[model samples]
Structure formats: structure tokens, C-alpha cells
Target: MSNDNHITIYEHEILRIDRGEKRVSVNQLKALQEFYGESGVPYYSLIHNGVKFCEYVGVLQVGDTLIEILPKVDKNLTDSEASWRKVLIDMLHAVGLFNLQAPSSSNLKLNSNSILDLYFELFVKEVKYLLRQGLVKKYRKTEGNSTSLKGSLKFGKHISQNLVHQERFYIQHTVYDTTHELHAILYKVLKLLLRINTNQSIQGSLKSLELEFPEMPDLKITEATFNRLHLNRKTQGYHNAIEIARMLLLNYHPDVSKGSNHILALMFDMNLLWEQFVYVSLRKFKKGNTTITAQNTRNFWKTSKGSKSRMKPDIVLNIDKADCVVIDTKWKNIKNYNPSPEDLRQMFAYMKYYKAKKVALIYPGTDFSNSSGFYYDHDKYGAHEIGKEECSVISLPYNTDIRQWQKQIALDIYNWVEVNDESSVDC
Candidate 1:
């Protein structure tokens, strides 16, 4: 209920506290229940009067109303107060949230002095970008009584209202509309963020944005609407900003009755986030004639006479029209640079099915020595006489410098694939 008790946590991180230490109030419990009912997953579990909070990873948001947990700050906290700003930008960019054409500048730092400051910064930036290019407009259908019959006549309404003899005609007009659904979403995000962010500067920026754009009733942005969004040359500049705005709106769970203070905080799942980041980076830096597929699951193997399971690898690399590599990213820290038995078996199955000569298991962390990479001979690893296939474990440290990390990953991928270039194995 208070800022002192609120703790910031990262995705997949658990928080447990005893009743005597910090008990969940009845109102907060109700809010949690409502959240679970809507999301079908409990944000926090209760055990014997103690609270075990589970924060979902992916995007960042505030969950102050339902729980006392906040987003975890970087372990190595800095005095500059802008340490996490670059990381946030890189994460957003990896997920295709930023326009590639937009100019990159370090001046675009976040005001992350507080829990929701980063979010506020992104919100303001998006609003300013949209304004610079102007808001998108479309023609919406309008219906009412008018002197001119511009569209189809509503004969039933005219007769029922006893205005048939009058000069007024029930008609419809397709007027050019400026208050499009996208603008409505933008307006909603600004309004919600403004309410939670106590920073006066952010609040003032939001107010200016609101005045520039027409006000519309808050609308829910669903997957359907997101898919339906289209862009042409005129509206292309707003594409990235619109996507960021949509993500902001999707994570927002606003309370209709209580207003902005009761809005559910935004958070992103770290596992999925890491996977996506890898996929995006690989695709972005892929070499010529190399095609990478994320979560490719078209192929399947029959388990029984009537049952079969799909083989959906995290990433499938097709080089020069051949299935060359099967790479799976692991977010966990590998102990002693040794992958678990289960992971080995999974990789083996993938190698056999894809007929890939090389399989790389990518992990996070930089402490491991890069000089001696983990490699296993297929015969020694229970491959029998199925020729010599190689499986290696590579460490990809999560660096705040996104460009450098991506470049290293791209180079690593190229080297791994080229290792088997001499063999000429066809799939």
C-alpha cells in the first residue's frame, strides 16, 4: 500500500514474505483475485498467510495496487540514474518496437529515476514522434438527419420519427475521419501513464499531447486490431510508434471504476523476451542466402499409430537452401559448461530430424571461458554410427551495448555454420 513496502522484481524472480513481515490486505487480495480471473493466472500465490509473488516477464509495468512488488533494477546500480535506459531501448528495438528509419541518438535517455519513469519516458517519446509526422486519418461512416441524401436513406427511422414530410432526410455520410482507432489507443496510453507517473514534466508533456489530438473514448486494443493495422507511405512513419503504443495499451489493465490509480502494471516474460531477442538479432544480421525461422513447427514425427507430436525448434537455420543448423537458446546459467541430459536428448532429436550436422545450444552469462567451447562428438554422445555430428554450447552474454552483442552473435552463427561447410551433407 505504501512506496516503502513496494519491492521491484524481475521476471521469473520469486518473492516470499511472511504474514507478520508483510501481509496482503483484503482489498489487495480482491484486486489480485480479479486480476487472476481476467488473466487466468495468479500474479501471486498465497500460502499460510504468507505471500509468494510471481512476476511475469517481458514488458515492464507497475503492479502496486495488486502486489507490493516493483520491477527489479539492474544489479549493478549506477549513480548516473540512466544505466538501464540503453538496455530498455535495446530490448524494445529487438522486439521490433522502434522504427529503423528513425535517427538514433544517446540524447534519447529515459528519466528512470523512479519505478515507472522509464515507461513515462517511452510514452512521451512516442507522443512527440507521432506529432512530428502528424496523426493518421481515415473516413468513418456517419449517420444522422441531413438536408442532403448523401448515402443510403434510413426509411424506417424517418417514418418512425414522423419526419417523412419534413425537408430533413435520414442519410449517411462517409466523412474523412481524424479520430482513428490508432489515435484513440495513443490517447488512452498517454492518459493512463499520466495518471500513475507523478513527475510534473511528464504530466505536462502528456497534457500537451492530449490537446493536440482529439479526445475519444478509451478503446481496448486486441490482437485482432493489432493485426488489422495497415500502413502506407503517408502513415509509415507512425508504424513503430504505433506498435510501442499498442504494447503499452495491451499491458495496461485499467480499472473502470477506480480510474488510473488502479491500473495493472505492465511486465514481460524474460524467457520469451530472450527468445524473441535472439530471433530478431539473428534475422537482422543473417548473411546472404541464409534464412532463419523462429519457432518453425511444420515438420512432425508420429509417436504412435494415431498420435504424433510436432517438432518446433526455437530456431531453424537454412543456409543456401539446406537445413544447416538447429539452434536453441537457453536463458539459464549452465553449470560447469555442461548441458543437462534432457537438453542433450532434445538437441539430438532435433539434429537427427533436421539432418543438421551442427547443433548449437546458446546460453546467457559471460563468466564462462570462451576459449574452450563445449563440444561433443555424436558417437560418444549415444549417436551410434549415424556419422559425426557436432553439438556445441555457446555463451551469449546479455550486454547493455546491444549493437556489440548482436554483432558477436552474428559472427558466432557464421563460424558455427562454416565449420561444417567442407562436409557437403545434403538434407
Candidate 2:
């Protein structure tokens, strides 16, 4: 995964990817515009003679170039792309999105060019592992013209074709082999990698895998095609390879008009990733008798004669059996600005519904410190008075050591939750 064909940009960044003998070529730009036009600007918006990346942070591949979009928090922190790229990969790994193998994950996170490249390398490894195990074979029904009769015979066609000779019979027979639907899907993904993979370091491995794998018929694949595949206990080892194949196959969008400028985008929403990352971090390093649940829902509003609406918070921390803290994660830097009225109101609503004394909005804080304050209520006459419930703003620290960063987030959350402990009984 070299930087020769890779381009890294931050979130909300704009670049003029024009046609020329430059880093991003004209064909690549055309492919990108086509993808953007079809995809409706989910990753980046198509602007005037350039592209403006949105809030999504992930790898997108068009033609032979790899575009790595990352999350940007501080504008003044002059850090290398390798550093942010490592952070992005670390976050993805923490949340169980990227299943990077050992030694390569630890040893080469810095050297990896983009998320997709790392993923392609992992796929190569999985295919190699399956190769080592020797592909599984199953009994499948196939039709062929044979001199020796087997199974059911196509009598009408056999009599017409072999009328004079009357020896060869077009028969449908059962044969146990590897040319099944699973192999067909895997072969398709391998062929796709051969055409789209730009990482030169692993070109040999891809070709080797393509050669080793038995050629399978081109299939019209869909979601149901994979859902219909059946795997036995003996073939359970294909789980990982199949999972990655599912992702790649489902996300692949081929060019119908030109067919050569196809785009394979593997992008993820930063907002959802951040929420899952925070929830996973807290759950991983939580204290005793504490539980963390994500997307916990509660019915809040309902029509008189219609279905009820639910209010789902990103995270809810419970102690024993009682809800303790309602936490909301935001993938933004909340430095030098107050929380918005909408966010505060949402937190308040969560506190009221979940019966949690405190609600916190967690942000990726590279520069902000944690702060907690009480909500205000109308006093006895008409003045404003401090309320009982607490609203805290917590910012988690960042570090190259991803585990340590997760642990720090857990520590900060626990400390903030117990800042004003009322039941302080010595253990």
C-alpha cells in the first residue's frame, strides 16, 4: 500500500480534481462525477469544477486511484496523513468494522495507504487461508452429453442429436465438486479485485488466488443469491471470506453506460461510526455493575389513533437495574462554543424519559475539557433557579495508542457521572 496512487483529504475539504497528467487524472474525475451523480452526494458533493467532501470519512476507489477521506477536528494541528489515517483505522477496528489481521494491523497500520487497501490485503489473506484449507466440494446437478449413461436421460434431445450413432446421451447427473454458488461469488469478487485493486504490493497474491481458484460461471448476483447459499459444518470456515465478499458485492456499483469507469465506494458515515465507537469503548472499559446499551428506544409520543413514536438515544448507561446516565455522542469538536438549544433540549427530554439524573453529550475533544452544570428552572416567584438534574459536556482525548484512548474515554465518563456523588458510602 504505497502513497503513489493514494490521495488523502479531510472532512469538508475541497479539491480541484481536474483532467491532466496529475495525481487525479481525467478518467478518474469522470468516474467520480458519475458515481457522485448516481450516489447523490452521500460521501462528497459534486461542485463547480471540483469535489467537496462531506462529513463521511472512508475510502473510495475510482479507476486506479484510491481516495481516503478522514475526520478533521483541529485546523491548526499540523500532523501527517499517516497519523490521521492510523486514527481512522483504529476507530474502525475498535468498532468491529475492519477485521485487520494481527502483525499486519499492528505493524503496518502506519504504512497502510487507505482503508480499502488494508481491507483488500485482509481479503487476500482470508482467501489464502481458505486455499490452505482446500476448498470444499458439494454434490451439484449438472447436464452434459456422455457416452456412458448416468442419472436421468434427456430422451427427446438424445434421440434427435444422436439419431444415427445412438451412443452418446445428454444426461443430467449429480457430481460433487467445487463449482457451486459460493465459489461463483468468491470468483467474481476475486476478478473484481484484479480489475480494481491498485495496491501493487499484493498484485502477485491476487493473481495467485485467481489462478488457484477454480473458474466459475458468471452469475447474476443479488442479495437473495447469497441468502440462498447453504453451508454445512464442514464448510463453516468460509464465514470470514464470505462476510467480506458480501460487503464488497453489495456495495459494488458498476458503470452501465461506459462500463470501464466503474466505481467501488466503501464509505461510512462519521456520525454513526462515532456513536458506535463511543458505545464500544465505554462498554469495553466499563466499571463494575455497569451496563451500556446502544440505540436504546422508548415510546414517547403517539397519535390518538395511530402508532406511537419512539425516542432512541445513542447510548444509555445503567447501574444494576436503574438507568444512571443518558449519553449522546457527537462527532464534532465543541470547542469555544456553547451547546445548541436543540441538543440541550434533546438531552433534557432523554433525562426526563429515562429518569437519569444526568445527561451528557460526548464529543471528540482534541482541545476541549469536560464541563458539567445544572439546568435552570423558574424560581418561586419569577427568577431563574438551578435545577436538580445535571447536563455535562465530555470530550474524549485522542492518542495513537487506541486502547489507551478508549480507556481514557471510559475513565472520563465514569468520573463525570460520579462528580457529585450523593450516596458516598465508604467501601
Candidate 3:
């Protein structure tokens, strides 16, 4: 089906709208429904003051405009209709979408005889009601003293208490300052529209190249082209994903719930960026005499039989000459000032079991304020005495993408291997 012939359905009916050059076509109706047919109790409407307004309908249009009375609601019970329209109008005005223009003489003439005449009439009635409310303040100020009156701004500054101020009266009726609120809301909407447009443009470009120039060589980004990609600024996905990850990582807050345990598990499991870094970094260690194995070695040794003491580090890079250097990737940093005894003992046990001298804990750099590497020497049984200089703790910043980090990790491992070949492998 042609995308153009869509009908917008609202409240299970087609809301005929003014589409300017576009017809009140079924396609437009469908598009309208998909875009703005939000279902809920109406919150604002045009009413002729307190009188039950039974006529007039509201239809939302593209670009933050609405056509009232153009496609009116045909049948309506009085009380419900009045309340619905009231909410609809108020909401539109609140959101700065209502920009009603005075009807021209010809328009009024047509409106008078039209089937939706009552809708127009009801709209005017509500406008008049507002006008009455506006006038009430104007006259009340003229008669009453302004000192004690708190309703309007004039009263706020006055010595006498009788008059209310116009400014305050206006403020009371508004959801937000219309001018400033419109500027922010419109800017936000435009930004979102631009992002979606960019995505569509990129897809279209790729399709065109495939169809018209299939044999052409693939597009390669040169230094000049590299500048065009603009990878510096954070993308929408980055911000959203990071925020979600941060919340889950800090699940220590009692009020911050992650829904079901299964959902929380999945949420943490989606730490793609963190996982990428860990795996790529491990690749480097494998290139030099050491082979890195995943899920083959336990992170922690089982202290007691039947006790689930095995710890599976994301990836373990074994040094071909000696024990393995263990590393773990964590999205969140260990916030406690001191590492838990269990964790320290686990790393120690890992060093003993794997018979590796070096160990490192990798955490996302964004989560930590400080970066420092340390060495621990426990010579209680001459353990550290035997290899006092071999065991070290390294803290590396997690920045660049996985590929870049992987290369760096490989270089670091190669350097370590070169320096170690001349020294004793065991303590």
C-alpha cells in the first residue's frame, strides 16, 4: 500500500483535519492518528464560561498546531462533552499549541450554517468565559484598594489591600511562562526530529550507492573524511545506556529498584562496552608466550569441598613461562575505602593456584576519581620474600574503544615478557 493513503484514526474514528494543501485524505488521517492520537481523558477544552459546552471538537495537526471545529465531534452528551473540551483546550494552551485566530466574516458565515456550528459556538463561548474572567480582574482592581489584594501584581506592590494585580492573575492561569516554555519545548522537539532525519538520510545514501554504483569501490574515510564523522560528542545511545548501567551498578540504593531479579540480571548482562574491553585486552597477553583462556580457570580457588569458591575471571592470560596474570572488568568501581578481605584473599589464592606473579583489577575509568597501581608482599611464609618484586597490582584507565585498548594491552604484555625472560620465573 502507498504510504500516502493512510487514514488517521482517533477514538476509533477518522478525525477530519485541515491539512492546508493536503486534502482531508484518509492517508493523512492515518498518519495523524499514529502521530498524535494520544488516548486519555481530555484535560482541556473551549467552553462558553460555566455553560455546558456540547459542541466543538479538537484535532491536532503537525508542527504543534491544532484545527478546532474543522472536524468536530458529532454526537456528545452535554456534561461529558463540556469537560472533555475543557481539558483538551487547557492542555493545548498549556503546551503552547493553541493559536486561535479570529474567524473572518465569510468563515463565520460558513461556520454558522455548518453541521459543526455548535463546536465553533462552544469554542467562542469558552473564549468569552475567559474574557469575562479577564475583565473581572480589570474591574475589581479599579474598585478595590490594591494593598491587601494578592491576586494580581498591582496589588502586590500597592500600599492598600483592596486590589488584585493583573500579573499574578495571569500567572495563576498558566502552567508555565508560555514564551520561555515554548522555546525550550520546541527546541527539544526539533533536536529529536533532526537526529531521526539524519538516520534516515544515512540509510538513503547507502541505498542509493548500492543501486546506482554497485561496482564502485567502497567509500573509505581519509583523514579529511575522518573529521567529518565527528565521533567526539556523545551519542543518544551512549548517554541512555550509560545512565541505565550506572543505575544498575549502584543498585545499593534501596529505593533504586531494578524490577525483577531476572530483569536486573539482563540489564547487567548488556554491558557490551565493558565486556569488549576485557576480551580485547586479554587478546594481547595471548600473543606473547602466554595463552589466554576464558571460563577455563577459576577466579578463586575452592577453600572447602562443595563450596562454590571458583571465581571465573572474564578472561585469563597465562604467561607461558610462569603463572597467569589475572584481570577482571567491572563497570563499577569498588567504593569501599579498603578492599574486602575476601577479595584480597581470592586474588592471593588466584596467584597461588595459577602460580602467576602479577594481578590487576580493571574497572571503567569513568567510575573512579583516582587511578593508582599497588604491589602487595605477604612474606608470612616467605611467599613475598621468594618473589618480592614479581607480584604487582596495576590499575589502568579504561578509555579508548576495545580495539585500541587491545593493541595497548598486547604491547604491555610483550614488554612484560621481554623483561621477565632474564629474571627468575619463580620466587
The prediction achieving the highest TM-score against the true structure is: 2
Instruction: Please provide, for model 1 over 1-427, each residue's C-alpha lDDT reduced to its tens digit, 9 standing for 90 to 100.
Output: 2233243344334433333434445555555455556456545554443335553433223334323233222334342323344555566567865444354212455434443555566667766776766667898988888877788888888676645558888776788867777777777777776665555666787788778867887787687877898888877766655766776666667656564335445554545656787888888787888888888775566756878778878988883245568888876666454777787678778877887767777776654323223234545667434345566676765566788777777777677677643332211
Each model's lDDT comes to: 0.61, 0.79, 0.34
Q: Residues 1-427, candidate 2, lDDT per residue (tens digit)?
A: 2254677778887766553232455677678887877647688887766788888988877666677888866766777778888888899888987766443233334356677877777778777777777988989998878989889998887887788877788899999999888888889999999988877887898999988989999998899988987778987777767877888888888889987767777888988988998889888987887878889888999999999999999998882245478999888887857778899889989988888977888988775476676777634666576667678877776676788888888888888776774421111
Reference-based TM-score of each model: 0.74, 0.90, 0.30
- RMSD to the hidden true structure, all candidates: 5.7, 4.3, 29.4
**Against the hidden true structure, what lDDT does model 1 obtain?**
0.61
Q: Give me the runs in candidate 3 sitting further than 4 Å from their true place.
A: 1-276, 284-286, 298-308, 319-323, 332-342, 366-391, 398-402, 416-427
In angstroms, the error of model 2 at 85 is 1.0
Worst 10 residues of 1 by lDDT: 65-74
Q: How far does residue 53 in candidate 2 sit from its true spot (Å)?
A: 0.9
Model 2, residue 30: distance off in Å is: 3.3
Instruction: Sort every candidate by lDDT, greatest first.
Output: 2, 1, 3
- In model 2, how large is the Cα lDDT of residue 112? 62
Give the Å error, residue 8, model 2: 1.2
Q: Which candidate would rank higher by TM-score, 1 or 3?
A: 1
